[model samples]
Target: MTLLALKNISLRFGGPPLLDGVNFAIERGERVCLLGRNGEGKSTLMRIVTGQQQADDGDVMRSQGLRIAEMPQDVPKGLSGTVREVIASGGGKVGAALAEYHHLLHENPDDLDRLGSLQQILDTQNGWALDARIDALVAKLDLPADTDFNALSGGLKRRALLGRALALEPELLLLDEPTNHLDLDSIAWIENFLADWDGALLFITHDRSFLRRLATRIAELDRGQLTSWPGDYDNYLRRREERLHAEAQEVALFDKKLAQEEAWIRKGIEARRTRDMGRVKRLYEMREQYAQRRNLQGTAQFTVQDAERSGKLVAEAKNLSYAAGGKTIARNFSTTVLRGDKIGIIGPNGVGKTTLLRLLLGQLHADSGEVRTGSNLEIAWFDQLRSTLDERKTVWENIAGGKEYVELGGARKHVMSYLQEFLFTPDRARSPTHVLSGGERSRLLLAQLFSQPANLLVLDEPTNDLDVETLDLLEELIVDFAGTVLVVSHDRAFLNNVVMRTLAFEGDGRIGEYIGGYDDWLRQRPVATARPAAGTKPKPAAVPVVATAPASKSPLDSKQKRELAELPGKIEKLEAEQEALGLKLATLYASDPGKAVETQKALSAIEQTLATAYARWESLESLRDA
Candidate 1:
């Protein structure tokens, strides 16, 4: 059954329509992930569907008694009172009933019927358990229950808001960038939570792993349109390409027909003595139809201008110790950075990932520590705070900064050209920094970072507001760049793609270095047995006990044993080629889109061959025993 239906949804503000006659529906138990580049009207459409905002022209229908709990990208302001009090009072069924009961008693000293009805609802919904639920969430999220909501930092505030939303336990959950400020552990915790959510879920997140694990369907809100594919993120990519290819074919067919009609009207109409007016009008209609599909564009293109090379040793830290306000950030931490090193930094919130980055850059003073830097090191910083952006200045002004031109790759390029490289048209270039979306702002930052001759790049949560496509591009560039990169990100898939190693913050001011990326780090770390509570199940133990191996197979015959020995070698070669193809796919994706397709097919074929070899080898070993 349809839980929500949005029909002919259209909205506009001064400029072109942000959403143009959009139509879609959410059925019960459907988990849909809404994706779009920053500022592509995703939030606007969400508001329309949730009844927080009315569409300029559309119809929205919600099933009777439908309940929704939402977590906005930015935490709401004016939230006062203790964290526990605010979160426990999100006004879900139990909370609402309890509050209403008290209100009626306050207004009239005695209202028995209303009081009884409200109390029944409160009891049925387990309203009294609100405190327990709120406490559990606060503890799990590492938030202080007694603190004032306003006193917490921005990240803490977002964490509290998420806890509140989760505590509400509504039938439908609407989350905007839910994992934006979460740490690796919290992100994983929430991923598991969403995995078991028994509701209609619609969330907007840039975390690719999260999307892959949670989304049963993927929806793209692009340039005033809503399109959906019936699968996870990977499947969505292939489907999107196929749909675009089909649309291209349709456009080609229309063009072919249009050409014939135009030719007939121009030269075959009796030397234009009497115009076939109907035929002429038909040609005009076809022209409009052709332009319509072609006009539909993506959010924006992303391109990273190449950077200059750096020396072998980018920077080094020995016994780095830093603390502020009686809290230790990093203690006796040390690491060496070599050129072309793409290292990822990950840790829990406030565990000093950002602090470590700053210390390496000499932005922070590390007490009693000596740091060595390469002579050719030129650093480019992508700050999560975005403090470098001038909100009052236009986009072009921010990039140009009181100059008519900028220096890119040691060449004096026009400011317009530099801005256009980031997909900024002339009109948008003039728009102020405050007007751009988060993704656009991120792109703008990249444009600025690439323009300068930087050998060392420091990124702090750089993927926070970027789309999946842009993330892919950034990953490729990081992997292929000739500089040293230190990126602090919670995006696991991105970290795996870009970084070869990771410097992890393992609580209590300690930093642990892992051999590979996020997944590798996860595999090496000890699993935490999360304390279970109401509505939460205890996690399975880290290592499950396995039964003894089946009775040893009888000794294989000489021929069977020989084939078995050769099978291992054959499988190894196939696997090696598959790994090579994976790397080739990355390079091919950046250089030639056409070859990427062929490379993927080849990779699939290799997997099948390897599977067949393994199956045959196993069967032969069993046959020899028989």
Candidate 2:
């Protein structure tokens, strides 16, 4: 049941090798995820595998007469028709068989053999039921069947393309970034659909949650080489770390032994003709081995500037209501935000997450509510559209604003040097913004934001197009940030690492606050109905419940339960430390300016430590009576 084999694959485009002697294979029912840094030729390898492009060296072997269908990253051009027609076209064999059967009837009504073969194909493929199946699929995917393919939104277009690819039911499915433009519901549906798929799947995507759930194996493409590990995402992470650590130790050991051998030879051991000649030759051989060894590269560096102290009452809304195009997005919503609060906004696409943010920022007037903000609040916004960047401006010009040098960390550095900090080359710095890749643009925007520290960070889909390394860096910065953050991102791993709580926008303008990340929100949602598909829940398996100490592990003691109820609010207020200190600092500023400065200093020092202290206290008290 082997689907395909790619052996000794080498692809070069007249420059550095894109893929170097790569070995890859897919068997039936294997869900493999191809991972790599941006611009590492992952897409190129896909094209080569599908025969859309050719590798300079190597062979792509497939079992004879195997069917392969691909959903490329970009929608191909010249596709003009309704969504239904396009999906039918993607039903390659069904459509082809139907055409052949009709043609045989027209060419020779007496040709029973050919007609029989065509009818058998048409019947086997369920050609007569094709339209109904496509309709159901399109409806499930929320794609408008009657709408022209080109007129659909980018996300919808991707769904349509995928629908077509799926209709074909090929032996192998190749997908690139399938979850990029999808909403949570759509992503969940795809995950469920792919789980039941019987064919082999190889895809590239930045969705860690998707990979964790569906990927049976992971292949990492780095430095023009492919390294595959058989496991899910979390398992791959642990194994890869161990593999790298082992490699480091091996290289260190070899270097140390080679150094000792070289030292012995340098001490005139080779001059002792018969006695030392063998040892001397061994030393030379060891040097050759050690010299050829390569070590793992360092990870990307990411830093966030310390934000200045802000008042505790960052921003709050009272009865916030908003409506656009005769549809309500937020209705009578009210919430308070405090300094150092990390809140994540999540909902289906176009569910007013951005509108709510704009209302809090006072960019939009709510229909019947008021927004209040502290004077000391400084906001840094990462727009989903990246409108802050000018397409006509070069990277250096966009960041530097015509200045050759910018002040960073109290030192004046050349703008080019600063641009290089984001891994942009000198030539790239001079290239217009339109030419940069999505990841590159995101990097530039982040660099600009990090350069100017702010007390409140509002990021919309900040993880979009960011590589795994940068995603890790961003998560670290958010966790360690001194300021408050309100972000909208679909990246589950990123949300889990960065946000302590989430604000989920349920349909029809109802906003609910859930404790914890995306997975936590899912847990709090209503059963299997949380996702798009209904009646698809698996039957629960029966299991015996064993009681520890004969069910003597009693309910949390009254005191512990009481503390648990109060902890969430208490932690929120504590995180907003500067706001809590506002009045005291103001009074001290009048009475003793120097004392006020010292008090302000103490507040910042204690804020983060206090949060951790409260968390530890909660954990201890929860287990105290149990």
Clashing pairs in 1: none
Question: What is the overall TM-score of model 1 with all chains considered together?
Answer: 0.80
Give the per-residue lDDT digits (tens) of candidate 1, residues 460-529.
Answer: 9999888877787788778877778899998999998889889987667778888898878877865442
**lDDT, candidates in the order shown:** 0.78, 0.79
Highest lDDT, which number?
2
What local lDDT does model 2 show for residue 44? 89
lDDT accuracy of residue 88 in candidate 1 = 63
User: What TM-score, over all chains together, does every model reach?
Assistant: 0.80, 0.75
For candidate 1, give the lDDT of residue 57: 87
Superposed Cα deviation of residue 106, candidate 2 (Å): 26
| CA deviation > 4 Å runs, candidate 1 | 14-16, 92-127, 253-270, 274-278, 294-308, 526-550, 554-626
Task: Indicate the TM-score of model 2.
Answer: 0.75
Clashes of each: 0, 1
lDDT string for model 2 (1-626, tens) is 55678878998886567888887767777788999888788888999888989998999888898889988777888877677777777877676565455546656879898888877876776887765677777877888877778987666788888888887668899999888766677777888888888998999988888888898668888878787665457756876788778977887888898888766666654555445677878987887776654334345465666667899888899888899988888888899888889999988776778888888878898888888887677788898889999999999988889999977666788988887778787888999999988778899999788767687889999987877887888898888888899999878888988998898888777888888998788889765336545215766767977766654455676886787777777777666774556446534533453465466556656666666768766675657656
Clashing residue pairs in candidate 2 are 312-579
